[model samples]
Target: MDKERLPRWGWLLAGLFVAALVANLLNLFVLVPTVFPEEYRAVTVITTMSPVLIYVGVWYDEHRQHYWEQSGAHIAGDVLFVVTGAALGSAIVLVAIIDFGIPAFLREVLAMGAGFLMSWGLFWWRNPDVYADESAR
Candidate 1:
Protein backbone atom coordinates (compact mmCIF):
# COMPACT_ATOMS: atom_id res chain seq x y z
CA MET A 1 0.00 0.00 0.00
CA ASP A 2 1.18 3.52 -0.75
CA LYS A 3 1.85 5.77 2.20
CA GLU A 4 1.09 9.42 2.65
CA ARG A 5 3.96 11.42 1.19
CA LEU A 6 3.97 13.99 3.96
CA PRO A 7 2.40 14.58 7.30
CA ARG A 8 -0.70 16.69 6.93
CA TRP A 9 0.81 19.83 8.47
CA GLY A 10 3.75 19.58 6.13
CA TRP A 11 1.61 20.72 3.27
CA LEU A 12 0.82 24.04 4.93
CA LEU A 13 4.43 24.65 5.80
CA ALA A 14 5.47 23.87 2.26
CA GLY A 15 2.83 26.16 0.87
CA LEU A 16 3.95 28.97 3.14
CA PHE A 17 7.54 28.59 2.04
CA VAL A 18 6.56 28.55 -1.62
CA ALA A 19 4.35 31.60 -1.30
CA ALA A 20 7.03 33.61 0.49
CA LEU A 21 9.73 32.58 -1.97
CA VAL A 22 7.62 33.46 -4.98
CA ALA A 23 6.72 36.86 -3.57
CA ASN A 24 10.32 37.66 -2.75
CA LEU A 25 11.42 36.60 -6.21
CA LEU A 26 8.81 38.85 -7.76
CA ASN A 27 9.96 41.75 -5.64
CA LEU A 28 13.59 41.20 -6.52
CA PHE A 29 12.93 40.88 -10.22
CA VAL A 30 9.61 41.86 -11.76
CA LEU A 31 7.57 43.80 -9.23
CA VAL A 32 10.05 46.40 -8.02
CA PRO A 33 10.50 48.45 -11.16
CA THR A 34 6.99 48.15 -12.49
CA VAL A 35 4.96 51.25 -13.31
CA PHE A 36 2.89 50.82 -10.17
CA PRO A 37 4.05 52.81 -7.21
CA GLU A 38 6.29 50.88 -4.82
CA GLU A 39 5.02 47.49 -5.99
CA TYR A 40 1.77 47.97 -4.09
CA ARG A 41 -0.41 45.91 -6.39
CA ALA A 42 2.14 43.13 -6.68
CA VAL A 43 2.54 42.83 -2.93
CA THR A 44 -1.18 42.90 -2.26
CA VAL A 45 -2.04 40.43 -4.99
CA ILE A 46 0.52 37.86 -3.87
CA THR A 47 -0.53 38.17 -0.26
CA THR A 48 -4.18 37.67 -1.20
CA MET A 49 -3.84 34.87 -3.72
CA SER A 50 -1.29 32.49 -2.23
CA PRO A 51 -3.73 30.69 -0.03
CA VAL A 52 -6.06 29.76 -2.86
CA LEU A 53 -3.26 28.37 -4.95
CA ILE A 54 -1.30 26.66 -2.21
CA TYR A 55 -2.62 23.19 -2.92
CA VAL A 56 -2.09 23.01 -6.63
CA GLY A 57 0.34 20.10 -6.55
CA VAL A 58 -1.04 17.96 -3.76
CA TRP A 59 -3.96 16.52 -5.67
CA TYR A 60 -1.97 14.13 -7.80
CA ASP A 61 -2.17 11.06 -5.61
CA GLU A 62 -5.55 9.49 -6.15
CA HIS A 63 -4.97 6.93 -3.45
CA ARG A 64 -5.05 9.57 -0.75
CA GLN A 65 -8.57 10.65 -1.47
CA HIS A 66 -9.32 11.07 2.22
CA TYR A 67 -6.65 13.71 2.57
CA TRP A 68 -8.11 15.74 -0.26
CA GLU A 69 -11.63 15.47 1.07
CA GLN A 70 -11.12 17.95 3.88
CA SER A 71 -12.67 21.37 3.93
CA GLY A 72 -9.24 22.86 3.29
CA ALA A 73 -10.31 24.53 0.07
CA HIS A 74 -13.14 26.28 1.86
CA ILE A 75 -10.87 27.26 4.71
CA ALA A 76 -8.24 28.50 2.30
CA GLY A 77 -10.85 30.63 0.60
CA ASP A 78 -11.84 32.09 3.95
CA VAL A 79 -8.21 32.95 4.63
CA LEU A 80 -7.92 34.44 1.16
CA PHE A 81 -10.73 36.94 1.78
CA VAL A 82 -9.25 37.86 5.13
CA VAL A 83 -6.21 38.96 3.15
CA THR A 84 -8.14 41.92 1.76
CA GLY A 85 -9.09 42.96 5.26
CA ALA A 86 -5.53 42.54 6.41
CA ALA A 87 -4.15 44.52 3.49
CA LEU A 88 -6.67 47.29 4.04
CA GLY A 89 -5.91 47.39 7.74
CA SER A 90 -2.22 47.49 7.07
CA ALA A 91 -2.73 50.20 4.45
CA ILE A 92 -4.49 52.43 6.95
CA VAL A 93 -1.59 52.05 9.33
CA LEU A 94 0.93 52.42 6.51
CA VAL A 95 -0.80 55.62 5.46
CA ALA A 96 -0.35 57.05 8.94
CA ILE A 97 3.29 55.96 8.89
CA ILE A 98 3.71 57.63 5.54
CA ASP A 99 2.97 60.97 7.18
CA PHE A 100 5.93 60.21 9.43
CA GLY A 101 8.17 59.98 6.33
CA ILE A 102 8.81 56.29 5.78
CA PRO A 103 9.88 55.15 2.31
CA ALA A 104 6.96 54.00 0.13
CA PHE A 105 8.66 50.80 -0.97
CA LEU A 106 9.51 49.85 2.57
CA ARG A 107 5.99 50.59 3.70
CA GLU A 108 4.41 48.48 0.98
CA VAL A 109 6.72 45.57 1.72
CA LEU A 110 5.93 45.74 5.43
CA ALA A 111 2.21 45.84 4.77
CA MET A 112 2.30 42.79 2.53
CA GLY A 113 4.48 40.80 4.88
CA ALA A 114 2.35 41.64 7.88
CA GLY A 115 -0.88 40.83 6.11
CA PHE A 116 0.44 37.46 4.92
CA LEU A 117 1.77 36.57 8.34
CA MET A 118 -1.54 37.41 9.98
CA SER A 119 -3.47 35.27 7.52
CA TRP A 120 -1.03 32.38 7.79
CA GLY A 121 -0.88 32.57 11.57
CA LEU A 122 -4.63 32.80 11.80
CA PHE A 123 -4.96 29.77 9.56
CA TRP A 124 -2.71 27.72 11.81
CA TRP A 125 -4.10 29.01 15.08
CA ARG A 126 -7.74 28.31 14.30
CA ASN A 127 -7.21 25.01 12.54
CA PRO A 128 -5.07 22.93 14.81
CA ASP A 129 -6.94 19.78 14.01
CA VAL A 130 -7.42 20.47 10.36
CA TYR A 131 -4.06 19.00 9.48
CA ALA A 132 -4.23 15.83 11.49
CA ASP A 133 -2.60 12.95 9.65
CA GLU A 134 -4.55 10.61 7.43
CA SER A 135 -4.31 8.01 10.16
CA ALA A 136 -6.40 10.19 12.36
CA ARG A 137 -9.22 10.39 9.88
Candidate 2:
Protein backbone atom coordinates (compact mmCIF):
# COMPACT_ATOMS: atom_id res chain seq x y z
CA MET A 1 0.00 0.00 0.00
CA ASP A 2 1.24 3.46 -0.83
CA LYS A 3 0.82 6.48 1.36
CA GLU A 4 0.31 8.76 -1.60
CA ARG A 5 -2.62 6.85 -3.05
CA LEU A 6 -6.08 5.85 -1.97
CA PRO A 7 -7.04 2.21 -1.66
CA ARG A 8 -8.82 0.64 -4.61
CA TRP A 9 -12.10 0.60 -2.74
CA GLY A 10 -11.58 4.17 -1.70
CA TRP A 11 -11.16 5.19 -5.30
CA LEU A 12 -14.34 3.33 -6.23
CA LEU A 13 -16.26 5.00 -3.45
CA ALA A 14 -14.91 8.39 -4.45
CA GLY A 15 -15.85 7.76 -8.05
CA LEU A 16 -19.42 6.93 -7.12
CA PHE A 17 -19.62 9.93 -4.82
CA VAL A 18 -18.40 12.29 -7.53
CA ALA A 19 -20.62 10.71 -10.15
CA ALA A 20 -23.71 11.22 -8.05
CA LEU A 21 -22.69 14.73 -7.18
CA VAL A 22 -22.04 15.63 -10.80
CA ALA A 23 -25.29 14.08 -11.98
CA ASN A 24 -27.34 16.00 -9.48
CA LEU A 25 -25.53 19.28 -10.11
CA LEU A 26 -25.77 18.95 -13.86
CA ASN A 27 -29.42 18.02 -13.74
CA LEU A 28 -30.60 21.30 -12.34
CA PHE A 29 -27.58 23.57 -12.58
CA VAL A 30 -26.57 22.89 -16.16
CA LEU A 31 -29.57 21.25 -17.82
CA VAL A 32 -33.25 22.17 -17.65
CA PRO A 33 -35.01 20.66 -14.66
CA THR A 34 -38.36 20.56 -16.38
CA VAL A 35 -36.94 18.18 -18.92
CA PHE A 36 -36.28 15.69 -16.13
CA PRO A 37 -39.23 16.13 -13.78
CA GLU A 38 -41.16 18.57 -11.64
CA GLU A 39 -40.07 16.91 -8.42
CA TYR A 40 -36.40 16.50 -7.46
CA ARG A 41 -36.79 13.19 -5.70
CA ALA A 42 -34.00 11.73 -7.76
CA VAL A 43 -31.77 14.55 -6.71
CA THR A 44 -32.71 14.02 -3.10
CA VAL A 45 -31.97 10.34 -3.37
CA ILE A 46 -28.65 11.05 -5.00
CA THR A 47 -27.72 13.66 -2.44
CA THR A 48 -28.32 11.28 0.44
CA MET A 49 -26.22 8.47 -1.00
CA SER A 50 -22.76 9.89 -0.32
CA PRO A 51 -22.25 8.20 3.02
CA VAL A 52 -23.76 4.91 2.05
CA LEU A 53 -21.47 4.47 -0.89
CA ILE A 54 -18.44 5.42 1.19
CA TYR A 55 -19.31 3.13 4.04
CA VAL A 56 -20.02 0.22 1.76
CA GLY A 57 -16.79 0.69 -0.07
CA VAL A 58 -14.76 0.91 3.09
CA TRP A 59 -16.55 -1.98 4.75
CA TYR A 60 -16.22 -4.17 1.71
CA ASP A 61 -12.54 -3.41 1.44
CA GLU A 62 -11.92 -4.24 5.05
CA HIS A 63 -14.03 -7.37 4.94
CA ARG A 64 -12.47 -8.73 1.79
CA GLN A 65 -8.90 -7.58 2.19
CA HIS A 66 -8.58 -7.36 5.97
CA TYR A 67 -6.85 -4.01 5.91
CA TRP A 68 -7.91 -3.32 9.46
CA GLU A 69 -10.13 -4.59 12.19
CA GLN A 70 -13.24 -2.34 12.12
CA SER A 71 -16.37 -3.79 13.66
CA GLY A 72 -19.35 -3.03 15.92
CA ALA A 73 -18.52 0.24 17.65
CA HIS A 74 -16.01 1.14 14.97
CA ILE A 75 -18.53 0.56 12.22
CA ALA A 76 -21.06 2.61 14.10
CA GLY A 77 -18.53 5.35 14.49
CA ASP A 78 -17.85 5.46 10.79
CA VAL A 79 -21.58 5.55 10.05
CA LEU A 80 -22.13 8.31 12.53
CA PHE A 81 -19.28 10.48 11.35
CA VAL A 82 -19.97 10.13 7.66
CA VAL A 83 -23.76 10.45 7.83
CA THR A 84 -23.85 13.28 10.33
CA GLY A 85 -21.20 15.26 8.55
CA ALA A 86 -22.94 15.01 5.20
CA ALA A 87 -26.43 15.59 6.57
CA LEU A 88 -25.50 18.60 8.65
CA GLY A 89 -23.38 20.09 5.93
CA SER A 90 -26.13 19.68 3.38
CA ALA A 91 -28.84 20.98 5.70
CA ILE A 92 -26.90 24.08 6.64
CA VAL A 93 -26.17 24.95 3.03
CA LEU A 94 -29.66 24.04 1.91
CA VAL A 95 -31.23 26.35 4.45
CA ALA A 96 -28.93 29.18 3.58
CA ILE A 97 -29.59 28.85 -0.12
CA ILE A 98 -33.33 28.57 0.42
CA ASP A 99 -33.32 31.65 2.61
CA PHE A 100 -31.30 33.65 0.11
CA GLY A 101 -33.56 32.66 -2.78
CA ILE A 102 -30.72 31.30 -4.83
CA PRO A 103 -31.58 29.66 -8.13
CA ALA A 104 -32.99 26.14 -7.73
CA PHE A 105 -30.20 24.42 -9.62
CA LEU A 106 -27.49 26.25 -7.74
CA ARG A 107 -29.16 25.30 -4.51
CA GLU A 108 -29.02 21.65 -5.40
CA VAL A 109 -25.42 21.92 -6.49
CA LEU A 110 -24.31 23.74 -3.36
CA ALA A 111 -26.22 21.58 -0.94
CA MET A 112 -25.34 18.21 -2.44
CA GLY A 113 -21.82 19.31 -3.14
CA ALA A 114 -21.38 20.23 0.49
CA GLY A 115 -22.77 16.89 1.58
CA PHE A 116 -20.38 14.87 -0.57
CA LEU A 117 -17.37 16.94 0.38
CA MET A 118 -18.18 16.70 4.07
CA SER A 119 -18.80 13.00 3.85
CA TRP A 120 -15.48 12.42 2.15
CA GLY A 121 -13.64 14.69 4.52
CA LEU A 122 -15.04 13.01 7.59
CA PHE A 123 -14.29 9.54 6.29
CA TRP A 124 -10.79 10.48 5.32
CA TRP A 125 -10.07 12.22 8.58
CA ARG A 126 -11.85 10.08 11.15
CA ASN A 127 -11.06 6.69 9.67
CA PRO A 128 -7.92 5.43 8.02
CA ASP A 129 -9.31 2.04 7.18
CA VAL A 130 -9.77 3.07 3.56
CA TYR A 131 -6.39 4.62 3.23
CA ALA A 132 -3.43 2.58 2.10
CA ASP A 133 -0.99 4.49 4.24
CA GLU A 134 -1.11 6.42 7.48
CA SER A 135 0.22 9.48 5.71
CA ALA A 136 -2.43 9.38 3.05
CA ARG A 137 -3.01 12.61 1.27
Candidate 3:
Protein backbone atom coordinates (compact mmCIF):
# COMPACT_ATOMS: atom_id res chain seq x y z
CA MET A 1 0.00 0.00 0.00
CA ASP A 2 1.20 3.45 -0.76
CA LYS A 3 2.07 5.02 2.60
CA GLU A 4 0.61 8.34 1.51
CA ARG A 5 -2.87 6.84 1.49
CA LEU A 6 -2.58 5.71 5.07
CA PRO A 7 -4.32 7.69 7.77
CA ARG A 8 -1.92 10.10 9.38
CA TRP A 9 -2.27 9.51 13.08
CA GLY A 10 0.94 11.33 13.76
CA TRP A 11 -0.52 14.55 12.48
CA LEU A 12 -3.47 14.21 14.81
CA LEU A 13 -1.21 13.50 17.75
CA ALA A 14 0.99 16.46 16.96
CA GLY A 15 -1.99 18.72 16.44
CA LEU A 16 -3.52 17.71 19.76
CA PHE A 17 -0.25 18.18 21.55
CA VAL A 18 0.16 21.64 20.11
CA ALA A 19 -3.39 22.57 20.94
CA ALA A 20 -3.04 21.44 24.53
CA LEU A 21 0.18 23.34 24.90
CA VAL A 22 -1.29 26.52 23.48
CA ALA A 23 -4.52 26.34 25.42
CA ASN A 24 -2.78 25.64 28.68
CA LEU A 25 -0.30 28.41 28.16
CA LEU A 26 -3.13 30.79 27.37
CA ASN A 27 -4.97 29.73 30.49
CA LEU A 28 -1.93 30.08 32.67
CA PHE A 29 -0.86 33.48 31.43
CA VAL A 30 -4.28 34.98 30.98
CA LEU A 31 -5.60 33.73 34.31
CA VAL A 32 -8.86 32.68 32.71
CA PRO A 33 -10.60 29.48 31.85
CA THR A 34 -10.47 28.57 28.16
CA VAL A 35 -13.85 26.87 28.17
CA PHE A 36 -17.02 27.94 29.82
CA PRO A 37 -17.16 26.46 33.30
CA GLU A 38 -20.90 25.79 33.07
CA GLU A 39 -20.38 23.74 29.94
CA TYR A 40 -17.66 21.55 31.36
CA ARG A 41 -19.84 18.45 31.47
CA ALA A 42 -20.85 18.96 27.89
CA VAL A 43 -17.22 19.40 26.96
CA THR A 44 -16.40 16.14 28.70
CA VAL A 45 -19.15 14.40 26.77
CA ILE A 46 -17.80 15.68 23.46
CA THR A 47 -14.20 14.84 24.29
CA THR A 48 -15.15 11.34 25.45
CA MET A 49 -16.91 10.75 22.17
CA SER A 50 -13.65 11.02 20.18
CA PRO A 51 -12.64 7.36 20.44
CA VAL A 52 -16.10 6.03 19.77
CA LEU A 53 -16.43 8.29 16.77
CA ILE A 54 -13.10 7.21 15.31
CA TYR A 55 -13.88 3.53 15.94
CA VAL A 56 -17.25 3.66 14.26
CA GLY A 57 -15.75 5.49 11.31
CA VAL A 58 -12.98 2.93 11.02
CA TRP A 59 -15.28 -0.05 11.37
CA TYR A 60 -17.50 1.27 8.66
CA ASP A 61 -14.59 2.15 6.42
CA GLU A 62 -13.07 -1.31 6.75
CA HIS A 63 -16.37 -3.08 6.20
CA ARG A 64 -17.16 -1.03 3.17
CA GLN A 65 -13.73 -1.00 1.61
CA HIS A 66 -12.64 -4.57 2.51
CA TYR A 67 -9.48 -3.16 4.04
CA TRP A 68 -8.70 -1.01 7.00
CA GLU A 69 -7.99 2.44 5.69
CA GLN A 70 -7.90 5.71 7.52
CA SER A 71 -10.00 4.54 10.43
CA GLY A 72 -7.33 2.50 12.17
CA ALA A 73 -4.78 5.26 11.83
CA HIS A 74 -7.33 7.76 12.99
CA ILE A 75 -8.03 5.72 16.10
CA ALA A 76 -4.35 5.42 16.88
CA GLY A 77 -3.82 9.11 16.36
CA ASP A 78 -6.74 9.93 18.60
CA VAL A 79 -5.32 7.77 21.35
CA LEU A 80 -2.04 9.64 21.30
CA PHE A 81 -3.93 12.90 21.22
CA VAL A 82 -6.04 11.91 24.19
CA VAL A 83 -3.01 10.86 26.19
CA THR A 84 -1.32 14.17 25.49
CA GLY A 85 -4.40 16.06 26.49
CA ALA A 86 -4.80 14.08 29.70
CA ALA A 87 -1.21 14.51 30.77
CA LEU A 88 -1.20 18.21 30.01
CA GLY A 89 -4.54 18.59 31.72
CA SER A 90 -3.36 16.77 34.83
CA ALA A 91 -0.52 19.21 35.16
CA ILE A 92 -2.85 22.18 34.89
CA VAL A 93 -5.21 20.61 37.40
CA LEU A 94 -2.39 20.06 39.83
CA VAL A 95 -1.43 23.69 39.59
CA ALA A 96 -5.00 24.79 40.13
CA ILE A 97 -5.37 22.49 43.08
CA ILE A 98 -2.21 23.78 44.65
CA ASP A 99 -2.75 27.47 44.00
CA PHE A 100 -6.48 27.95 44.26
CA GLY A 101 -7.51 24.88 46.22
CA ILE A 102 -9.79 22.22 44.77
CA PRO A 103 -12.48 23.82 42.70
CA ALA A 104 -16.11 22.97 43.17
CA PHE A 105 -16.92 19.56 41.73
CA LEU A 106 -18.52 21.05 38.65
CA ARG A 107 -15.65 23.43 38.04
CA GLU A 108 -13.15 20.63 38.41
CA VAL A 109 -15.03 18.57 35.87
CA LEU A 110 -15.26 21.53 33.50
CA ALA A 111 -11.55 22.22 33.71
CA MET A 112 -10.81 18.66 32.69
CA GLY A 113 -13.41 18.86 29.98
CA ALA A 114 -11.77 21.96 28.59
CA GLY A 115 -8.48 20.15 28.37
CA PHE A 116 -10.04 17.23 26.55
CA LEU A 117 -11.87 19.50 24.16
CA MET A 118 -8.70 21.39 23.43
CA SER A 119 -7.15 18.17 22.24
CA TRP A 120 -10.21 16.86 20.45
CA GLY A 121 -10.68 20.08 18.56
CA LEU A 122 -7.13 19.93 17.35
CA PHE A 123 -7.58 16.36 16.18
CA TRP A 124 -10.67 17.30 14.25
CA TRP A 125 -8.93 20.20 12.65
CA ARG A 126 -5.85 18.24 11.66
CA ASN A 127 -7.83 15.31 10.25
CA PRO A 128 -10.61 17.14 8.53
CA ASP A 129 -10.32 15.02 5.43
CA VAL A 130 -10.84 11.76 7.29
CA TYR A 131 -13.70 13.18 9.27
CA ALA A 132 -15.29 14.59 6.17
CA ASP A 133 -14.89 11.32 4.33
CA GLU A 134 -16.30 9.33 7.21
CA SER A 135 -19.28 11.60 7.45
CA ALA A 136 -20.01 11.31 3.73
CA ARG A 137 -20.25 7.54 3.92
| Candidate achieving the largest TM-score | 2
Q: For residue 43, what is the lDDT in candidate 3?
A: 33
For model 1, the stretches where C-alpha displacement exceeds 4 angstroms are: 1-43, 52-67, 80-82, 130-137
Q: Candidate 1's residue-wise lDDT over 9-67, tens digit each? A: 65556666676677666666766667435625545455644463423323434443444
Q: If both were scored by TM-score, which would come out higher, candidate 1 or candidate 3?
A: 1
Colliding pairs, model 1:
none
lDDT of 2 by residue, 1-137 (tens): 45238766676666677766766677667544556453343345444577566755554554434524657787678678877777677767776667676777888778778887887888788765566574553
Ranking by lDDT: 2, 1, 3
What Cα-based lDDT does every candidate model obtain? 0.56, 0.64, 0.50
Per-model TM against the reference: 0.45, 0.55, 0.40
Best by lDDT: 2
Better of 1 and 2 by TM-score: 2
Q: What is the C-alpha RMSD of each candidate to the true structure, in Å?
A: 7.0, 8.0, 11.6
Worst 10 residues of 2 by lDDT: 38-47
Q: What is the lDDT of candidate 1?
A: 0.56
